[model samples]
Target: MSAKYGSGGWATVAIAQSVGATGALIAELGWGVTGPQRVPRLSAVDKSILYRQSVSSRATVVAFAVLPVSVITWLLCDFSRISAIVISLGSLCLAFSPAWFFIGDGKPGQLLAYESLPRLVFVGIAALLIHYDFPIGWYGGALIVGSVTALSLSAICSHLGFFHWKQNWRTIRSQKEVVLGRAISGSFTSFAPALVGLVNPLAVPVFAAVDRLMRMALAILAGIPNRLQSWLGAATGRDRHLRSLMSIRYNCYLGLVSGLIFGLLAPTFVTVLFAGQVSFGYELSALSGFLLFLICTSRGFGLAMVAAGRAKHITISVLCAAGVGVPLLCVLGLYFGAVGALAGQILAETVGIVIQSRILSMKWKSNRQWSTYAASVLQS
Candidate 1:
């Protein structure tokens, strides 16, 4: 895209994706975060019910969200307004994804069938179109086609026909706390590209390009915690605690190694991915690597906390991180450009990881003290 449309056009696409991500989150209403935590213990019937409710709730939000998201993309994009809107729509349509359902159910086949495969086919089609010199806007159109197909496949597979909008709305309202927490937590990262666009529009090409790469890495790394959620959640008492500890340790090591590789390889990868149309330096790569490390490590702690029913702590940690990170990102971006902005991201992620680690420590201490008390009482 950068080769064909230039950096400005690619930057517009990146910002559109960023905005669309936030819209998708809003449409999800925190279900994406909470669904995996609950789905493990549900029966087939109960899981079906949960899926219906999620679709209904998200559908309600999407109805209201689409217009605003399109408007935002139109306002934000400096190039190719139509492409931006199409990409944003595609991103918003992901609200219908059944990925959390399959992940929680341990059904990789279903996940691939219902979500991944359809998208993969459309992405291939998109590549062909791009190669043939179709308008870049068609790439976004392909995304829309892909997402809708995936959603249709999911609906067909599940046989979910009815959605009680009223009942689902009530359920959505009941989960306001979790939804709000997720929204606040997601605000900074999801909107970071738009924020950069606001301050340094020219720098957005470089920053958004790097941010897009980091997001892909983060998604790949996310498989770790997604796997661990089921592993740790399915265990009991002391076993669960032990699993959580192991999960965190494993993620920490992976985070360190991945961060190193990311720092070393990002410059080359970005250049290669963009066909050398856009690129960044080692310094930016290093900062992005540091940010990735903090996030990857903390994901383990966050998921463990969720499994332990300490989700409130995760919310608090995210709140603190966003509160500090957003402003710092904007201020640093204003003065130091992309480098300063990346530094701010590193700081914010660091703050979040510190708070999360502390909370886990406190929980461990509390658990140990309670175990000791119970043992003494039994002995007496």
Candidate 2:
């Protein structure tokens, strides 16, 4: 897409992606965050019920949000209005994904077959369209087609039917804390590009470039915490504490190593991926890498807390981070451009890590037996 479209076009795509992602996050209703932990505990029948409730609740939210989200994208977009709106709508279609369902069910085959494969195929098709000089709107249409197709296949295979609105609403209310935390956290990341674009159009492409790479890498790294969520959720007593301790240690190492590698390789990645169209220097790339490390480490702590049923602490941390980060991101983007925004993200994630770690430590202190077991196990 970058090769086909220059900086201006890429900026518009970034804005559209931002708006669509924000809408999709709302439509997901925090299911992706909390679902994995819940799935391991549910019976087959109950699992189906949960999936139905999630779909029903998320569909209703998307029905209401589509128009407003498209309007927001249009307003933020300085390039092509039609293309932006289409892409925004395409992104919103991701709400239908049943990935969390499959993950929690320990069915990677289902996830790959029904969700990942279809999405990849459609994305490839979209690329072909772009290469052929087809309207960019076709790219968004392809996303919609891919997402809906995957949802349909998953639903049919899972034998899902009948969505009860009241039941779904109740489910949403039950998970309100998780939903709120995810919403705030998702917004800060998804909307940052648009916010920066509002201040510095020139910085949008550069910021968007690094942000895209960070997001892609983070998506792959997400498997670690997600796998831990399932493991910790299913475990009890000493086992759970042991897994949590291991998660913290390994995630810390993963963050340190991954951040260093990404910082060193980011310039080359930009040059290769964008054909040197996007100007990303070492200093900015290094800062973005630091931000990525903070994010990965913070996510590890937050997901561990969630697995331990400490959703409220995660929500509080997200709220605090947003309170500090949002204003800082905008101000920094206004003055120092993308570098300032990256710094703001790093600071926000640092705050989240501190709060989550503190909460987890408190929880450990209250559970003396588990804490001692974990410490001794680590020593051995």
In terms of TM-score, the best-performing candidate is 1
lDDT (10s digit) by residue, model 1, range 62-152: 8898999999999998687887898888888877777877777777787788678888888788878877877676777777787677667
TM-score, prediction 1: 0.94
CA deviation > 4 Å runs, candidate 2: 160-166, 369-380
TM-score of each candidate? Answer: 0.94, 0.94
Candidate 1 Cα deviation (angstroms), residue 8 = 0.8
Structure candidate 1, residue pairs in collision: none
Residues 107-218 of candidate 2 have per-residue lDDT tens digits of 8788889888888998889889888987677778988998888878888886765464667667768867877887798757888898898878788999999999888888
